[model samples]
Target: MGLLFGSFLNVVIARVPAGESIVHPRSRCPRCGHQLAWYENIPVLSWLALRARCSSCGLPISWRYPLIELLTALLFLACQRRFGWTPELVAALVLVLLLVPLSFIDLEHWILPHELTWPGIAAGVVLSWPMGWGRVQDAIIGAVVGFLVFWGMEWLGEKIFKKEALGAGDKDLLALIGAFLTWKPLLAVIFLSSLQGAVVGSLLLLVRGRAGPAPDPEPGPESTPAPPVGPEPVDTGGEEKKAEDEEEEEDDWEPGPTSIPFGPWLSLAALEVMLLGPLLREVLPVPLDMLFAGAR
Candidate 1:
């Protein structure tokens, strides 16, 4: 069932980015625009049978579809194993669904749509009552703390760097996740996310060479190129125009993709916290249980 659900999720993943309604239109091949038949749409099995190619166009499908389906299935099974049929199980499942979409979306676009995050927070808070796990107060406080702390970090980053440091969506994402788990596990999520980000970033840097600087935006087709630097009467002949251009370019440039799909990182962090954060609490040097017990 989870695998099947994940297949549908692939449609969501592809369509949501294009500002399309995920529920209205059915799935189709991107290359050929062929609407998939029910048989051809059967999650992992269909992918395997088709040999990861579209039935209509013979286009090689991305392996990500099957992988995501399989991953989601395993995640669902793991939650069921741990939590059984409790409301916590439902909450965990919701997290998995939302995270799957958010993770991939952020990876592709570096944006976490309010369409996901805001609704997630609302749903998380609403469902907390049925789960009877955390109090409403805790969820509210978590959201507040999560947003404010991250927003402060963003402000500080911008002030220091003289550039926007974090996307507004990132702050919203933290708030949304924190609303569900409250402050304690949210902290765990942030810590784990930071650790993961650093490790992944370092590995990528190593693999891809020191990150290349961002490219300048491509000029529109109709735009004309500026003439090469020539003798402009400047402050003095002592100041070389060529040297000034180089310095200006260096100062003005921003790094390319300093933003990794942070939504995905946050999603993974939330997943870890949801599943095993309390266990980690037991192992922490300072007893996190003592700190969060009152909040619970």
Candidate 2:
């Protein structure tokens, strides 16, 4: 089941940002446009059997495909081990479903599409209904508080630094986490995500001179900007086209050499809190107990 869901997640990650229907196109090779057969789409097994190449075009498939399938399977297994056969396990797995794709999308595009986060926030709250009104209330408060906290930081950072400090999508993602885990552990979530992201970002900056993943190549000529060396595109469309282009440039914020996506870190911290909370609490000192105040 995990593998099956993970396969679907790959489609979600690929199509959601592009505003494409995940269902309509069916699985196909991007290079060759060869639609995959049922047998050719069997998660990791299919990848292995094909030797990581597209059968039609012989183009090497990306390693990310098999990795996502295995990663999702392991996370599902961990959730079961942590929560057992319980209602809470269902919530945990759903949270996993949300986080994996968001993390990958942020890593690639530096954007977390609202298509996923907003719906995920609702799912988190809805999933808590089975636990009674108190938990539901907590989930609601968690979502609100989670969003407001990041929003306040974003506001303050702009006033102080005169630059954007956080992505707008971050608040939504945190709200999603809060709905699932409640507001009690939000401070810890923030602390853990920041600490881990900082440590990793610094190492990446030192080793590779950039803290973010390299951007994927955009398909088609329109996706790439015109080179300055090339003849300028005709201005026959007048000022409207220029204004639209400027608007696009203003909306898109490309990461600098040191910029790192926080979504993946947040997802990692959420998974750590959910799966390893008990072990962490037992091993951590008394001073850290406040961090896990909401641990089950």
Candidate 3:
């Protein structure tokens, strides 16, 4: 079942980014544009058979496809083992898969698209009813509070820092999580996720060096400059200016970098709560306990 779902997840990962339906469009090789046949799509078996290369183009397919499939399968099986054949286990597995896609998307593209986050919020709420995890009232309250808390923090952070701090996608993600975990754990998720984000973001900035002067100032009427005064000013002059631009671009690409995916951190927090939050409440140290006593 996990392998099968991973196959479907591949379809989702590939097509969702291109604005294509994961159901309607067949899977194709990005390198060669060859539509994969059914046999070629058979999860791990196909990857092993093809030797991790596209059949037609011989382009090396990313090992990540099979790895993700196998990883999700193991996670699903592990959740089942831990929680057994229960609605809670199923819901937990769903959250895991959703987080997998969300984490990878953010990692690769630095984005958490609405295709995942908004639908996830709705799915979490709808599925919660069927799973009997919480009442509709609880889920609804979770959604509202979850969104507003993050939104409020975002407003405050901008005022204090004079820069956009939280990504909007993160708010949507918390709202989705709140739909499943309810209002209580939302606070835990926020506290832990922010701590994780600060530590990880600082490391990434130290490594990536602040991403090219904050990315051209987010395009506004004021930020958008008037057209050049005269002709385009071609490079008829010195090699020095061109060399400077190349040096700047190279500096942007330098390595020794780290960027943590916050979705994974958020997912880990939610999973911890799902797995052992109750247990921890009984055993946590006084200082940590004091901070989240209201959650208890």
Q: Rank the candidates by lDDT, best first.
A: 2, 1, 3
- Summing lDDT over every window of 10 consecutive residues in candidate 2, give the lowest-scoring window: 228-237
Candidate 2, residues 1-296, lDDT tens digits: the string is 88999999999999998899989889999899999999999999999999999999999999999999999999999999999998899999999999999999999988889999999999999999998899999999999999999999889866765456788899999999999999988887888998888777767756775566755456333444322110111122132222223222334444555567889989999999889888888988988976897876
What lDDT score is found at residue 8 in candidate 2?
Answer: 94
Best-performing candidate as measured by lDDT: 2
Estimate candidate 3's alpha-carbon lDDT, on a 0 to 1 scale. 0.66
The alpha-carbon deviation from the true structure for residue 226 of candidate 1, after best TM-score superposition, in angstroms, is 20
The lDDT per prediction is: 0.69, 0.83, 0.66
What ordering of candidates by TM-score runs from best to worst? 2, 1, 3
Q: After TM-score superposition, what is the CA distance of residue 29 in candidate 1 from its true location, in Å?
A: 0.8
Query: Candidate 3 residues 1-296, lDDT tens each?
Result: 89888878877776676688878757888888999999999989999999999999999989879988997898788778767887667677888778777776665644568888888888777777865544556777888888898789779866764433455677788888887777777777767765766565555545654311132223333543222111112222232222222222221322112233456667767766666666667788877665445342
Per-residue lDDT tens digits of candidate 1, residues 22-69?
887677888999998889888798899999998888999999999989
Q: How many residue pairs clash in each candidate?
A: 0, 0, 0
Error of 1 at 196 (Å): 1.2
Single out the weakest 10-residue window by summed lDDT for candidate 3: 227-236
TM-score of 1: 0.80
Q: Which of the predicted structures, 1 or 2, would earn the higher TM-score when compared with the native?
A: 2
TM-score of 2: 0.89
TM-scores for the candidates: 0.80, 0.89, 0.74
Give residue 24's lDDT in candidate 2 (0 to 100).
88
lDDT-wise, the better of 1 and 2 is 2
Cα misplacement distance, residue 1 of candidate 2 (Å): 1.0
